[model samples]
Target: MRHVDPAGTGRAGAQAQPDDHPLPTPGTLPDTSVTDPAVNHHVNPRTDDLAVNPGTDPAVNPGANPGMNPERSSGTNSGVGRAVNPALNPAVDPDMNEVVGRDDLLLVTLDTLRYDVAAELAAQGRLPNLARHLPGGVWERRHAPGSFTYASHQAMFAGFLPTPATPGPHPRLFAARFAGSESTAAGTWVFDTPDLVGGLAKAGYHTACIGGVGFFNRRGALGSVLPGLFAESHWEPGFGVTSPTSFEEQVRRAEQVVAALPAGRRLFLFVNVSALHQPNWFHLPGATKEAGDSRETHAAALEYVDRHIGRLFAAASARRRCFAVVCSDHGTAYGDDGFTGHRIGHEAVWTVPYAHFFLDHGEPTT
Candidate 1:
């Protein structure tokens, strides 16, 4: 319930003292060696037991692992609870066990990206790298759990990601045990812990947080709450919302971390891409601060992110397979109904873009 400023402004990088770690200039090459700075949804009325089609059930699927238990075969770390049944979860692929926990997990939050902007960018070919991994070659429209960074991300870490715009029990990809939860399907990876971060750690995955935006700057107790959940968390001056090259810096760090994680161990990497946040005019050529951030600038910011995100996907999937979730925490307002920012209820502030996909094992895609 911490109140966060929707407008990420001058003090966004408070934790990273400029004197100690100078922020990188827009055109400067990313400094991969920079030191660490600080630290779904659905509804439905169905019960836990579901009658999945036997023909499509992993228990009967020839491609499923023969020794894996269909009930517990969520393909997650051993510490997690068994999924009810993958057969009932359309989100869970029948061949999920073939890749699930066998690969690394990556979650990228495109902070404040609107569903319309992202969809348009993808359709216009401005987000080629990201579009390639989208489930249907486009971003899915969804409702954010919260209207602002802190609230939305809090729900997210606790397994309440954006729910599909559609109605009636959209099965979750992951969930924690709780009574009266109608969205937990057979394919949902039910974790015993209260939060997904802790759940993954218990399952023996190395969890890391590469933060962006003011909420993740760790400048105060409120900021520390989210990143503190991870085994390792990082933040830097260049990684905040104010930086024009934040996504580049973020991807560079992701490459370094992915390369350095312990061999043979799984990784749960979460990155909050700050480039899409406010003060994004820099992404537009010759655009001055006076332009005051608009949807056009927002799309440009996404294009900037797309230009470098492939390297991150490549790095994470280089050795083992990688499952990625890319979505915005929430959308922002650009004078829509006279609303200039988020934190208040509005269509522009509620609707977000979401997508999930897999990267197969191979050398990084250059």
Candidate 2:
């Protein structure tokens, strides 16, 4: 069985014609470093962030101690999977209060991408689309909240994202009101309802979703659960996990959605890129789906997706100011010690790449 990340600290959309504004390069964004943990240390039960322990949180259900992860962590190899302590780490991007209504939000999930693969490719210059943020944003190793799309995404939409393992606890930036949590940081957005879509809706942002795989397809009873979280969600057969043109088709719809939105209306756009999920043999001539899931295949698929992502970047370039989160829900195992896919326990399945950056069309604000 693949080993998912233990509940650890870890911590969208619109459409219609885009305004003529060009993506402005803010002089410099404020560092995302959070306030001293000492201030956020006191847990307030009245707050909205979820407070379950990663190991024992029923929502995540993985083991508690990350030190026991046999495959990745050992006494001898100290650099492989170190958690960046949230207490000391600064926020990589602006907080909700800063961007919510003022800037459009674009949330992107790169399904099944591994940390090592993404880093290697980016280092090799194969991902120019993702490279733009390298100088000003973060590209750190973040542990996934779950081992698969359904489980991981649920945690994300709830605002319980992957935590850096630096030793101290990191307060959540946003959370569902249902959990009765008290870990929300100051200025964070706390949802009064279970669904975050409801929270964003309250803030006047037009929320939309573009589904990439079956889990978000809305084709059946179970498939609709995730997509239903948004005010508007869309999917097509061509966007399935294995479809060769999945990214291209998704970009087409995204372009339309961005182009049709009326000016001055902020968007909360969510997208799940499924091309790298599975049965990606089409990326490699002789690879078989049964055994085609590999780092090699993942790299090729990432390049393909990155190219398409550039198109969305182009569309977002027209907005006044935009905030984006580009990350992987979880990594996958390619026969590592015989673990072939995600969902159980494997280091490769838990570690993912995370980044946060802003795109603005106007000058910086004081």
Cα deviation at 103, candidate 1, in Å, is 1.7
TM-score of each: 0.77, 0.71
Query: In model 2, what is the error at residue 129, expressed in angstroms?
Result: 1.5
lDDT of 2 by residue, 224-310 (tens): 678767655667777788698998988787776677565655567888999889867677667786775677988889888877686
After superposition, the stretches of candidate 2 with alpha carbons farther than 4 Å from their true spots are 1-93, 135-138, 177-182, 285-291, 362-366
Worst 10 residues of 2 by lDDT: 39-48
lDDT of each: 0.71, 0.64
Which number leads on TM-score? Answer: 1
